[model samples]
Target: MAPTIPGFGYRRVPVADDVALNVAVAGSGSPIVLLHGFPQTHLMWRHVAADLAADHTVICPDLRGYGASDKPSETDGTAYAKRTMAADIIALAHALGHERFALAGHDRGALVAIRAALDHPEAITHLASLDVLPTLDMWDVMHGTGAAVGFHLYLMAQPPGLPEQMIHATADAFFGHFLDVWTNNPQAIPAEIRAAYLSASRAAVPSIVADYRASAGIDVEHDRADRDAGNQLRMPVTVLQQDWGAALGFDAAALWNAWAPGLRHTTVSCGHFMAEEAPADVVKAIRDLLARC
Candidate 1:
């Protein structure tokens, strides 16, 4: 059987006609949905979700096109846009009987969470983003020699066919590379859970690439439009990140502050997989975000 968050009940929620997300839910009271990052599933939240579930209704879902969730064909650039994925998340919350809730996401999931908070401000009471910049700022900051670290972003951003074919040809190596390099505490991901993440990612290459491809195209466009319109996230926000700004040559707090007026920015000393590497810190950050909201 697949490894799962202990004590959490599972559900297959239909967020759209073509997409149904695999969700793990627990606890009660105010809801908070957690979206997983690239090369991972909702399982990444096992430690954090379990902790948050003590009081909040924790909803962790395998976002569309990853893990056990439905992967609709990426017929167009917009098909995998963060805007579209954000809609799926909103729909998932509505279907779960939540009209408004707190939201937190990591990596690619963070990008989607940012989009959701931007487009549906009324529905998100509190927001937390783990280890990523907003779409437009992400593209803007990723230039010069520093950008070399995100080679995969550019590789996957290419025209669909080659990126899909190349990644599919060596899926495990491709997915496992991130799992190995992006974690400060490798032991945080035990052998069994690591295997589960690898298997799930290996089976979802094309859709995953399409998801990244959208970031380079449609997602950026949407963010640019919002930026031009002077739109900002109208909710309490918490951003926990590695000191990527020191290496990447940007002020992480200033960037997030531009998008979120009510923001709390923190720099963690863990690797990209902070949710696993430093689950306690993540839980504290989230709990703090909830209190402020």
Candidate 2:
């Protein structure tokens, strides 16, 4: 079973006729939707979501394929695109009686929130993107040694067949690599929760592959089209990320400033999984962003 926050209740929320998100909801104020990253489900937000619930209705959902959510076998890759995933989030909040809400995404989910802020600007009251760059910028920054970290980005970007076969061949190790390396504090994810993530990710090999593959192809295309058009995030935007650019030789804040004027970008001292690694900071950053809106 997926880990749960004390007061939250589970719901299978229908975003479309064939797709429904397994969501956890709690509290009863302005709604704020939290999206999880790769190799994880909404369960990643256990602490942060629970904290936010004190003053906000927090909705954490498995992004269509990672947990007990619907995982369609189709692989055109467009279905897993951030644009489509963003729509799922918007539709989910609407279904739960939220017309305009704060949206936060960590890792893969950050990409979706970025898309949501770009595509449906009016619907998002505030936006918090944790530990990621835009798709185009992400690809643009990786070069030579800098590109070494994104081995999986190139791996899954290849046309489907092989990536799925290889990962499925040894799913736990593949998923566990991130859980192992991405966190500075092993205590952030205890034994049982890590097991849950590993199990869910192993079962979600296909959709996870398709989701990353979309980033390499369609997600980049969507991002380029926006950058070319001079689109910017209209809402109050806060980006909390590890200073990857410092180590990787790029200006993370400058790249984000190009897309988000007056952006509240900060270099967090934590591992890649900020929500879990630094839940208090993540919660405060999100709360601060919403207060601005």
Candidate 3:
């Protein structure tokens, strides 16, 4: 079950030929869509969404395959490509009565937001990405022994069959590992939310794996094409990420600058789950981003 977000009501918003996402919405001002990451649902934004609800209409959605959203079995591995996921977000906002909106994403959702901002710049007025680099930069920075932190990225990047089989065999343990390792504060994500993540992850094994697999294949191609074509996120963009580039011998801000021309980049001390682990900071950064826009 998805955790209850205070002052937020749940609804399903249709956004594609056949895809509609389970979204939690609140407030009544200018729209701000918050996309959740892997191993978790829109529930992760419980606090942040509530905080923003005072001034913005917040739309939090479980990216198709997770939470109560419809999960279709994949025929081709591109089912959960960020491009497709981004379209789902765009259409969701449109259907919600917002032709354009401010967008922010954490982790995998950040990948989707990146694609959305690049693919439909006019639709995303202001953008924020928490604890992530773009797809191409993500691959470029993770190399050699230090990249072991992202072992799951490599494991899930494998051709569909085995990654699916192995993970389904121990879904809770596999998904729970992230909830365990990625956070500095255990209390931020309560026991109930953690259980919700494990349950949702276990129930959607194949689609979730397809989501990961697409990043290594089609997602990379899209990011590379954009980079080669001199595409950048043409919006007021703020990025709050752990300085993983310091350890990996790359410049995270400089890399993001290559993509976000008017970028306000900062390295936060929070864990990967910044929305939960450091929500106040996330909210402040988002407010600042939106203010400038």
Candidate 1 local Cα displacement, residue 47, angstroms: 0.4
TM-scores for all candidates? 0.99, 0.98, 0.98
> In order, what is each prediction's RMSD in angstroms?
0.8, 1.0, 1.0
Cα lDDT tens digits for candidate 1, 1-293: 99999999999999998789999999998999999997899999999999999999999999999999999998767778999999999999999999999999999999999999999998999999999999899899988899988999999999868988988898889888988988888999899998999899888888899999998999989999999999999799999999879887889899989999999999999999999999999999999999994
lDDT tens digits by residue: candidate 2, 118-207? 999989989899999999999999998879888999998888799999999989999999899889999998888899899999999888
| Candidate 2 collision pairs | none
| Candidate 1 wrong stretches, greater than 4 Å | none
lDDT of the structure predicted as candidate 3? 0.90
What pairs collide in candidate 3? Answer: none
Best by lDDT: 1
CA RMSD (A), model 3? 1.0
What local distance difference test score does each model get?
0.93, 0.90, 0.90
What's the number of clashes in each of the models?
0, 0, 0
Tens digits of per-residue lDDT for model 3 on 1-293?
A: 34689788988888876777998999989899999998889999988999999989999999988888888777876679999899999999989899999999998899999999999998999999988889988898888898999998999999868999999999999999999888888899898889988898999998888888888889999999999999988899999997567887888899999999999998889788989988899999999998995
